[model samples]
Target: MSKVTGDAFNFSLLKRVMAYVKPYRATFVWSVLLTLLLAAIAPVRPMLVGFTLDQHILKGNYTGLVNITILMLVLLVFQTAFQYAHTLLTNKLGQSAIKDLRINVFNHITKLRLKFFDKTPIGQLITRTVSDLETIADIFSEGLIAMIGDLLQVIVITSIMFYMDWKLTLAVLVPMPLLIIATRIFQKAIKVAFQEVRVEVANLNTFLQEHISGIAIIQYFAREEQEYKKFEKINVRYRDANIRSNWYYSIFFPVVELISAMSLGLLIWYGSKTILNNPTIEPGIITTFIMFINMLFRPIRELADKFNTLQMGMVGAERVFKVLDTQEQTEDIGTLAPQKLTGNISFKHVWFSYDQDQEAAPKYVLKDISFEVASGQTVALVGATGAGKSSTINILNRFYEIQKGSIAIDGVAIKDYQLAYLRKNIATVLQDVFLFSDTIFNNITLNNPEISFDEVVDAAKKVGAHGFIERLPGGYHYNVMERGATLSAGQAQLISFIRALVYKPAILVLDEATSSVDTETELIIQNAIDKLMEDRTSIVIAHRLSTIQKADLIIVLDKGEIKEKGTHQQLLKLDGYYKRLYDLQFSSVGIAK
Candidate 1:
């Protein structure tokens, strides 16, 4: 917690960090004041000891010696107290500022568009938010202010040594150049080492996060040994970077100690000779010079390390600010917040591309796709993989913007509605149902206070999930564990259906929602969908053609374009893409139109 101010720092980044520090400026100011007090008091002790040895001890004035001893003890107590306050206040200031920063980082991350996440590694973001911020915390606790205090202490001690005996002080400082050279080399090496360590740590975090999440796939494919080898490589790189940083520390500290010992030896050797030749040079001054040299060298010994801490904080600040400055969040400029909508939907010649940033001709995923679904009808989308079936759903909910055309609901453009409002009204259940690690009830309600427990029960019963849920030990309160690990695939899918039902969305979307369920569970889900879509406009995507045979309309997509649209019987009669897809899906069961 020594003064940590002497190193090169990015003032621009420091200014940004100062914004968070503004709230705690008073505490910060107090901590600075304590650092100054500690620095001023640190040099006073040796001078007092020198004074006691000269006037009191040499004169054999026993009472004055006792008084001076008590006075020095009081000064020691004050220095210790000031140091305690300085440590407490600086650490408090750091944690308080970092807490606000962590909040802002999390908020920005949550608001960023999903597209940003697609390109970014989750582990890198994690490092920026958690590990980097912790390092930045050290900038305050062990860095800038403490560095300043050390610099001031060095100056004060050096000044006093010169005032007492300039020649001895000059002789002792002949070794300063060596320490400086060593410190500069150590600083440069350690800074690069720290950067490497940070990079390697981020890589390790990314590797671990992805591997752990996909551990099932790895094990199922029998690639554990290969994965372990890959992990070992990453782990070794991280270890090497840390070892390099530690090596610099190992070299630097011992060099400081050796140079300091040389300086002290020079001090004693010169001072003893000077006093032996000249009676005017006090023996007591030698003792004070010894104390001064040690005190002065202490901060010098540690200043380079503190400067590196500040530099790392700036580096960390740069990364965190970059995320905060990202402007790719989903646009929510629309002010309309309707309580409900009729869910009459229309897509007029819509086009979209996943790679919107490409300068080359954009590869459109959905090409001039147009469709309509009345307020109370179900429109099933039939297509092969990458045929733009789900792209329609993405555009409808505004997960991605279309390059052309418009999507409207109840004759109002979807973009005219507030983004959150539009999304809340359109509930989509994907093939991969994600449930949080929480009680089943919380997962269903998503911890919304407005949705009562009775509503959840009703939804679960409608989906035919209540029987199985109640049979569990804690029933609705059963802990699902992470990503619903404690629940079967069918059970998780059923819970998602119940969740969708309780929300009571105006427009329901089922994108292969029953793909994970067994035959019996799929049938139960089909019945649940029948009831759920009774009065709601619905869009369905399924590979199983039988599931959507009774839909009001079935739209077939091929290679990013709509090929046909009609009822099941009508599409079969057309003898086109829908007819072929339907035949292919049902041919395995010995049934085809």
Candidate 2:
């Protein structure tokens, strides 16, 4: 998780966030104008009441009182209109700015390299894009613009009060310094509290998303109680964080209210004495001052609350900017535009390590690896669990950069080709197949409108998936729920094969693609694989010895280095690592007949 600074306010972050609002500058300017209009109008009603009380009521003039009442009514109508416009414009500006920010975050996320996702949790990114952005929107709708309006109201109300009677204004303002100090304390304390709240929110989301996605594993191992306990601990931390934020609110608001009451008390005590001593001091003036004091202190109180919103939004902006500022993005500097690739792949002295940041020593997962496969040939990689077989495929796809040496295709470096074009030419089918919550046809084509329905159907039929797919209720249109939970493991793998075939890739890769299917289904998949392998470069990673027995070449890897490479019969004759691995499988399973 990215850490945010403890500073209560960040002007740099504010400036960056304000840039998003630049597109809606006209609406924001109009909102500010409406806020000024509202502040100016707010003090009029109290002044009218004081004038009517002193001039009309005291003199018992009915016509004069009625005229004053009509004027107050007009001010009320204008105030209401301005208030409505301000609310609407501020909300529109907030929402519009958030929309642009969300799109940019998503686009940046897609451009990031695989290593970033490997370390960062999916839920944390979701929170940044969704929940955190919404909080930022609150800064515009309820925080920044709203705070400015409150400040304007306070300033306007205070100006009017001092103009009316400077002595009473001083009396009303005596308690204000204490209010300001208390508010400053609250701001600092609540900023820290909200940062904790955001951290816990991201943690809770990460834990919940992880467990929810792996619910099957928990249930399979009967670890429900253990997992529940873990979740309970995270939930408690989230609750405690929120409670601390509430504690600040609980203490701060009442303190503000107490100071407001004290100011009112002082006004009444002093105003009564002044009126008693001087007969010229109108009673209506005291009444007007009381209204003015409420208007002034009310905005001050609301401003404290809006300050909290602003702090939380700044924290969100900081986290969001951290992602946007990441330097680990995949650099797509390749300019090659080859109309056709010959499908020849070569690796020379390749070395890689997933733990690139290790200070002591980075452990290489693949070391001094070298191999080559001609166009239209089949090569199989056989290795134990930590033997770097998958790392080879990952590097070939340029998902991760190699620490040393180079991987090339058709005598040109892999990085020389555009990233999108390189991946498009190399189709991959992993052991674990993933399908989105959409129709089967869309899942196969990945909603690519360019691939017609006939093309999808032809791909499925070629891979022997047409029989099972046609049996589905909606056939190709059948909706596979989340992760294709509705389909069997064999069925999902078949969809993956169809997806790869639809693209007609120049190179096809099967990373234990048939390991999860039953024998009957494996036979169907094997026949399809045989057909797909014809006239195309293919790479197979398999634990099952029978699957790669007929490969043109088999490479055996041990601890990140190639131990042996040859045809299966030749490797058997040498009695090397590949032969031993083949023996371990065949001797135990009676040759997988």
Best by lDDT: 2
Per TM-score, the best of the predicted structures is 2
Per-prediction RMSD in angstroms?
3.0, 2.0
Q: Estimate, for each residue in 1-593, the C-alpha lDDT of model 2 and write its tens digit.
A: 33444443677888899999999989999988988888778888888888888999998999999999888888888888888999999999999999999999999999888999999999999889988998899899899989998998888888888898999999989999999999888888888899899999999889988999999999999999999999999999999999999999999989988998999999999999999999898888888888887888888988988988988898899889898998887678998858888799999999999887757687999999999999988899988999999999999998889989999999989888999999999999999999999999999888888899999989888888899999999999999999999999999999999999988889999999999999888989998888989889999999866668868889999999999999988998898787788887777877742
Candidate 2 ranges beyond 4 A from true positions:
1-8, 358-360
**lDDT of candidate 1 vs native?**
0.88
Worst 10 residues of 1 by lDDT: 1-10
